[model samples]
Target chain A: MGRYFLSKLIQSLVLLFGVLFLVFMMVRVTGDPAALMLSRNASPEQLEALREEMGFNDPALVQFKHYITGAILGDFGNSLHFKTPALPLVLERLPATVQLASVGMLMAIIIGIPIGLVGGFTPGSVVDSIGRFLALIGQSVPNFWLGLMMILFLGVRLGWFPTFGRDSWNSVVMPAFVLGLPVMGQLVRLTRSAVLEIRGEDFIRTAHSKGLEPRTIYLKHVLRNVAIPLVSVIGVQFGYMLGGSIYIEAIFAWPGMGGLLAQSIGWRDFPLIQAIAVFTSLIVLLLNLLTDLAYSIIDPRIRYGR
Target chain B: MSIILQVKDLVTKFYTLDGVVNAVNGVSFELNEGETLAIVGESGSGKSVTMMSLLGLIPMPPGKIESGSASFNSEEGLCDLLQLSPEEMRDIRGGQIGFVFQDPISTLNPILTIGEQISETLIRHKGLSKEQAREQTIKLLSQVGIPDPELRYKAYPFQFSGGMRQRVVIAIAIACTPKIIIADEPTTALDVTVQAQIIELFKELRDALGVAVIWITHDLGVVAGIAERVLVMYGGRPVEIAQVMDIYKDPKHPYTLGLLRALPSLEAKESKRLKSIKGTPPDLLIPFKHCPFASRCDYAFDRCWEEIPPLISVGEQHQAACFFDLEEGGPRHD
Candidate 1:
């Protein structure tokens, strides 16, 4: 187990570094950092001074080496637009993004799994049909459109909750729901299929033949078997939620990393963009690692080396 | 001996897109107490379906029992297993009658421990506490002849070998001391030597616990080793039912005779190659108006095609669904 953990950790590090390199290259390839930093009307002398200060004058390899070494020490320079350390700027919004993602994931699991189980257990039932209908809308209808609908219905007309900004608990609900709906849809389908597949298994018949209560058979026997794929979908959905929340935050004015990201990209804030991308990649890689570990724990048949 | 369980006119069918598939049609038999009854048939012969339908293990919707009544004498009273509520059936399923299905690898839950799987029945049917169930689980595991019971109790299904896994499945089946065990080809997936061992285990359990067993398999060899009475199913119905010795010594039905001929017997001297029954079994989608075995039977005549032959008593404790009078004509060749 320790060896498995170590190998996974190493793989994550390599992935993190690879992502960092790609993001760094992308920021550089797009446009000049100095040109974005200084105003369009700035004098050539001022632009030159800024470029020298930011190490744009150095060789590309040297600049990359400097950037990576500093990143290793948790230094990502300062955001040109905000005039604050990029790492700290991203960290300040991390909790809010984490909160939105976590709530979205929690809601997806709570709502989606039961629907999946029901739909899967009885494929042609009313509950299954309803679940499939909802999932269809969830998957096909864009989240941006859903966010707008929620805003128009719940926020603007109904006055049930505040429309924009992360002021109260009410604000998180709309954005979180919009983000969770698509994930929940995917989860419903996945869970249903997984359940359907598991239901056909001989072990299920064995459980039934054991005279176990339906509740025990469903939860302990069936659900436990369904958990591995369920957890993986959750992990993948979390990463997707993180990436997809940018538009959601913009629509709802939720002051999360997504908002930070949009503003940084618009302003061409190189350091801030790089920091956020690296952090997001690290988190995604870590989540995948955790998912692999969870598989071994959930199903004893799955061992690391053997 | 008194009958432990008696099934009559149990008709199970599968609804497919094209048409309804008649899996098991009007199958009926008796399982006597403390006796081993083997239901023998080739693949798709409804042997497994008959056993699964008896336990209510067949999933509804696609698969349904059109008509049937299985009367099992439980401690509460004699009740038709087919008519009992799901809750009542639950009490009888693992408690009164245990089932060991084919493919032990698929039969055992991959995630749960052997102890947990065995204790599940003990807790539910026997009402044993967790601690007592664990102790009994260890005993059951050892009873199945696993080398180290304590160590194996915590082991998963994948950790055990094929024969060992079947043994664990057997352990779970016999856990609550069920009156009758319905084993559907339990040893079919095992190696030859292991098959013998599983057969031996079944006999030992039957003798020790005095529990009647309904062992379902296509292998006549395994049946000869374990079962006393043999049920030969052909095309979703029982074509012949007789004692083990009678099935071998003086086979009556053409299908049963074909099965015996197909077996590679050590006593045979002339023929180097084993005799195989000519032609395939009939498709079960269409209704069987005549004998199901008519097309495949060498002795099939004009009467065989016109009407379904009922199982008539040919001798004491022997029955065959054949129109021909084999007594005077003797065995016919193609």
Candidate 2:
């Protein structure tokens, strides 16, 4: 187990480097940072001074070396728009995104798993039909559209919640639900199918023949078998929630990393964009590693290297 | 002899997209206390289906018991199995009739340890506490000849070999000490060596616990070794019933004779060719007024094609579903 975890750690570190390199190269090579930072009417000498001061005039290789070293040492320079430390600025926005994504995931699991269990248990019953219909509606509608609809329906029409901005606890509900609905729909469908398939396995029949209660049979035999595959989907969907939080956060005016990244992209803030991209990639890589570890823990047949 | 269980004209049908397929058509049998009854047939002969129906294990909607009456001699009285509620049936399933299925690896949960699987049955049916259940589970495991029972108790299904897994399944089946044990092709998925060991285990359990067993299999060789009374099934119908030696030595039904001839005898000379039964089993979807095996039988005649043969008595405790006289001229081919 120790050896397995060590290999996963090494893999994650390699993945981190690959993501950092891609983000660094793409940000620098695609557009001129200094040109974007300078004013539209700035003189040529002023632009040259700014470029020299920012080390943009240095050789690309030398600049890359300095950037890599600075990034490693927590010296990400100043944000062009915020005029603050780039690392602190990005870190400050991370908790909001984490909070939103975690709550969204919690909601998805709480709502989705039970629906799936009921659907799988009865299969062709009314509960299954209703679950399928709800899942279809959840999946077909866009997240932004759903967010807008919730804001209009609950926020404006009912006057029960705020339309935008994270001011109160009630403010998190709309955005989280908007972000979670589609994911929850997919989870419900996946979990139902997984449970249905597992219920047909010979082991489950054996359990039934053993005179176990239906509840015990479901919880002990069926759920454990279904959970193995559900873990991977949960991890992948959690990563997706982080990625897809941009629209929901924007609609609710929640001051999260996704929203900050969107603003940075609009202003073409190179440091902030690079930092957010690298951070998002790191989170995704970490989630995938966690998922692999969870799978191995659940089923010991899969070994990392051996 | 006291009859322990009696199944009368049990018919199981499956409602598929095409039509109603009668998987088990009007099958009947009886089991007395402490008797080893073997249901022998080829694949799709409804041997397993008929046994599953007796226990109410057949899935509903797709598969249903169309008509049947299974009576068990319980403490109350002879209770009709078909008339019992689901809850009442649940009480009888593991409490009175224990079942051991084929494919032990698939029968045991991969996530749970062998001890847990065994204890689950004990706790549910025997009402044993966790500690008591664990103690009994260890004893049961050791009873089934699992070496180092304590360590094996913690080991998961995949940790054990296939033979050990089957032993674990048997341990679970006998956990509640039910009066009857139904082993459905228990040795089919095992190796040849393991098969003999499992059969021996069943015999030992029968001798020790005095539990009646219904061993279901398609292999005639297995029935020859373990069973006392044999019921030969063909296309969802029992074509013959007799004692073990009588069925093997003086076989009556053409299907049984064909099955016995199909098996290669060890004492046969090197130059002799082994007989093989011709043609596949008849499709149950097509309605048959005559004998289901008429198309494949060598002794099929004009009368065999026009009339269905009833299970007629040939001798004391021997019955066969054939019109021809076994003593007169054997069976005449058309």
Candidate 3:
């Protein structure tokens, strides 16, 4: 188990560094930071000074190493637009993004799993039909459009909640629902298929033959079996959900990392963008690793096997 | 001997998109108390379905128990198992009648520990408290002959070898001291050596606990070793049922004769190669109006195709579903 953990940790580190290198190189390849930051009419002396300050004169590897060291020390230079340390600027927005993303995920899991389970257990029932219909719209219909629709109907039309900005708990609901709907749809589909497949397995027959309560058979036996697939989907969905939330945040004007990301990209704030990308990649990699660990827990073969 | 369970004209079917599949057609048999009754047939012969139907384990949609009456003299009372409510069936299952299915690799839940699986039955059916169930579970583990019962109890199904896993499945089946234990090809998935051990384990468990067993298998060899009475199923119905000795000594039905001859017997050594029954099992979807084994039977005639051969008394405590009498070496009228 320890060996498995060590190997997984090493793999995650390699992946993290790979993302770090790609994002770092991408920011450099787009345009010279020194030139992008300065006006076109700037003198050579001024350009040289700015270039030197930004470490643009140094070799790419040396500059990357300097950036890496600075990142390690929690100093990712300063956001050009905000004139604040890029790491801190990204960190400040982390809580809001975390809150929105987690709420979106929690909502997806809590609502989606039961719907999928019911649909899987009874494929043609009314509950099953309703679940599939909702999942279809959730998956096929663009979430940004859904967000806009909510704003128009729920926010603007009826004035049930504020149209924009993260002020109260009510503000989080509309944006979070939009952000979560896609993953919920995916979960519903995945869970339904998973339950349908598991229902036919030999162990399920054994469970049934055991005279176990239907609740016990499904909740204790089938659901635990269903969990591994659900966990992996959730892990993969986290990356997409977090990535998509940027647009969702923009629509609802929720002050999360997504807004920071959009603003940073528009202003060509390399440090801020790099910090957020690195942080997001680390989280995603960590989640994938965690997903792998969860597999061993759910299945003993992995935990105890050589 | 008291008939613990008697199934009559149990017909199970599957309502598929294409058409209705007549999976098990008029399967009827009696399981005596404290005796191993082997239900023998090839794959897709509905050996498992017959037993599963009685237990109410068949899924409602697509698969359904079309018509049946399984009178079981359970601990609760003599009730038609087919008519029992799902809740009642649940109570009878794993309590009054235990079932150990084929493929232990897939039968046991991969996530749950061996101890937990066994204890689940004890707790549910036996009404044992967690503490009592755990203690009983440990005993069952040891009873099934696993080494280091205490340590092994905590291990999952994958941790055990094929033989050991089957042992765990058997342990769960017998955990509640059920009146009848239906083991559907329990040894089919194990190696030859392991198969012998499982058969031996079944014999011991049956003798010790005095639990009637319905051992379902296609292997006549295993049946000869363990079964007291043999039920030969062809297509979806029983062609013959008799004392195990009578089945081996003087087989009645042509299908049973073919099955006995197919075995690698000492008397058949001069034959060079073992005899195989010709042709596949009948297509169950079309429905059977004639003998299911007619196409494959050596004694098949015009009458064999004209109508279904119902079970008829052939000898003392013996029945065969065939128009031709092998004893007389000719066809017999109704």
TM-score of 2: 0.93
In terms of lDDT, the poorest run of 10 residues in model 1 chain B is B325-334
Write model 2 residue lDDT over A1-306, tens digit each, in one string: 778878888999988888778877886776776777766787888888878888988888898888888877767678889988788888888788888888888998998888988999999889889988888888899989989988999999998989998788888888988888987898889989999999999998888788778889899899988898889999998997775377888899999988998898898677878777777887898899999889778765554232
- Give me the displacement of residue A8 in model 3, in angstroms: 2.6
Candidate 3 Cα deviation (angstroms), residue A203: 0.9
- Residue B293 of model 1 has an lDDT of 87
Candidate 3 lDDT tens digits, A1-306: 888888889998888778878987886887867777766787889889978888888998899999888867877788878888898887788888888888899999998999999999998889988999999988999888889999999999999999998888788888888888888988998999999999889998998888999999898899999998998889888766665367888998888888989988888787788888888887788788888898878877777763
Q: What is the TM-score of chain B alone in each candidate?
A: 0.96, 0.96, 0.97
Interface CA RMSD, all predictions = 0.7, 1.5, 0.8
Better of 1 and 2 by lDDT: 1
How do the predictions measure up, each by TM-score? 0.94, 0.93, 0.95
lDDT of 1 at B66: 93
Off by over 4 Å in 1: A27-44, A57-62, A303-306, B267-271, B330-334
**Candidate 1, true inter-chain contacts retained:** 0.88
Candidate 1, chain B, TM-score (2 decimals):
0.96
Give the Å shift of residue B175 in candidate 2: 1.4
Name the lDDT value of residue A105 in candidate 3. Answer: 92
Please give me the DockQ of candidate 3 compared with the native complex. 0.78
